[model samples]
Target: MSDLAALYSEIEQKTSTFCTTYSIACAQGCGTCCEHFMPDITASEARLVGAYLLFIKKDFSLIEKVRQSIGNQEGPCPLYRFDSPFHCSVYPARPLICRLFGACAYQGKNGFAVFRRCKYNEEKTMPEHIDFHSEVPVMQDYSYLLRSLDDQEGEVGFLPEKVASMLDQLQFLAVMLDMDDTNPDDTPNPMAS
Candidate 1:
């Protein structure tokens, strides 16, 4: 796999492990966070997600839906299909922000790390002495890692628009490759090539 893809996979695993260890989890079917908040993603993440939608899922309609939702300031994520069994259609390729949303750690004013849980997770209480900085991945640190691989400077903005922009860039790259008699689909791994 490409370095970006590998890094993304690693981040996912680390986030999952941290959440499980801290008993921080989002309630099933709870779209409150999805509806109210937009995920901040890096350009690399946007490209990966867009590639997943185009190459793996092959869901162009959903891509267009994402494009349409660019200016949508509020409501559920454009990727959230109400009728679908899964809350997030592109769950596997979801960005870091989405993966670490409910269970995250932040540095408090006193220079100590504080554990933050979803408001929906009322039943689970974090330990008083929980050390978030040591256990959980810091958002800024991960963001820097992701951005290091790409020229894109900072948070790529809201997820939908970022995905749309990445998809457009990917399509352009594909066209450029096609002109040279290279079929992007025929390759065993687009990311590796």
Candidate 2:
């Protein structure tokens, strides 16, 4: 779990740098992407989000939402909060796809990095397109690294189902750890490794 967190941190730093260098940014307070998209994420990503929600945010209702959204492939993502400036409920533990989308370049067929402006960027804060010959953070690179860290129990699936499954596993572990004596809810997290 710590390894996954480290990977996420590394991804965040790389994507942020890439976005900054390219002046790519989401329009402020706009969650247009989340509104129409559901991320397909790995087991490790789900574990981190589930742990963050179960232990950190302590939001059971959101967990229920995750469960309810199972089998929903076309969706406004379950974590999306329409009213929040940070629309994602689990921003800190958002999946790799979420971290990379619109913020980093994709590996082009020519074996170089390419970036295009997000259609939802109505503010035109980001560039229309970029062709890069130099090294840049590519989605495919981060994806391979992320998959290497996953335990692959749930494998990769839509955000709702994967997260719900991981949340259940985490909750069962919490109960088995003895809720009355050593409260994992408040203790230093085991990170659900």
Candidate 3:
């Protein structure tokens, strides 16, 4: 879990720098992306989100929302909160794809990094397109970083299904492993092999 935390931190820093350097930004208070997008996430990502929901946010209703959303491959992410200012209920624990959605570049067929405005960027705050000749934070690079931290060889499922499944498994372990007395920070990482 510490590995993931470190990886996430590195990703945040890199993406922030990349976006800033490119003058790319998302529209303020607009969550149209999460509104219709469902991310595919690795098991390690699911475990982090599940643990955050259960132990940190203590939001069982959100957990129930995720449970109810299983097999939904077209709808909005279960963690999206329409009424919240932050929008994503599990923002800090969101998966790698979520973090990289509008912030990073992708390896292009021309062997360079490319970034384009998100489809949801109707406000068009970001640049329409940018090609990077120098090295940039390419999505594939971060994909590998996330996979290296994943215990399951980076098997991915839609966010709702993965997080729901993780919640069920983590719950079973919590009870059997008697984790009630442990602080959230002290709890054993379910994502660890």
Candidate 4:
């Protein structure tokens, strides 16, 4: 398998394990975190999402929606269809950042802090809430694994964008998947990458 494919598999596996352990009810219709800015994902993530869309034969329409969703709002995500709150048009193909929510971490005094909940989650209670932050595994470790696949020389900041931009840059199917990983500058991007 390609490096991109391996990264996707690892991410999916880790995300599934984390969600299951937390009993996270992230089924269709739950657009809580989706409302926020789309997370900045690595080029490999974009490739996987694009591939999944191609696998389902929904690339065109989904990309179109992503394109339209750009610059719409910082609140409700464009991929979220308000009329039908039960499905994400690109659920399986959603970006790695989207998959990382609630299970990922933020740097802190201690190595990294697990993002245990979201605004919606704090207001709502569920049986699965078992204080996983104190014990459960996290997505950060998997992120380390992805970095191992490539040097990823420096710190890459976050930038939310329509899925179209990701797909366009991915160029996975035919365009060619190329990356510039030698640069080691840790500069923060003023806008979303």
Better of 1 and 2 by lDDT: 2
RMSD each, Å? 5.9, 4.9, 5.2, 10.1
Alpha-carbon local distance difference test for all models: 0.71, 0.84, 0.85, 0.52
Tens digits of per-residue lDDT, candidate 4, 1-193, equal 2774666667677667766765565444566666655555565555555555544544456556666666654645555566677645566656555666665444444664445455566545433333334644455665666656643542232323524555555434232322222111333333324
Which prediction has the highest lDDT against the true structure? Answer: 3
Q: What TM-score goes with each of the models?
A: 0.76, 0.89, 0.89, 0.59
Residues 97-169 of candidate 1 have per-residue lDDT tens digits of 7766655566677666677666655555444336644646766667677777776465567888889898888
Count of steric clashes across candidates, in order:
0, 0, 0, 2
Model 2 ranges with Cα > 4 A deviation: 180-193
TM-score of 2: 0.89
Query: For model 2, what is the error of residue 57's alpha carbon versus the real structure, in angstroms, after optimal superposition?
Result: 1.2
> Which wins on TM-score, candidate 1 or candidate 2?
2
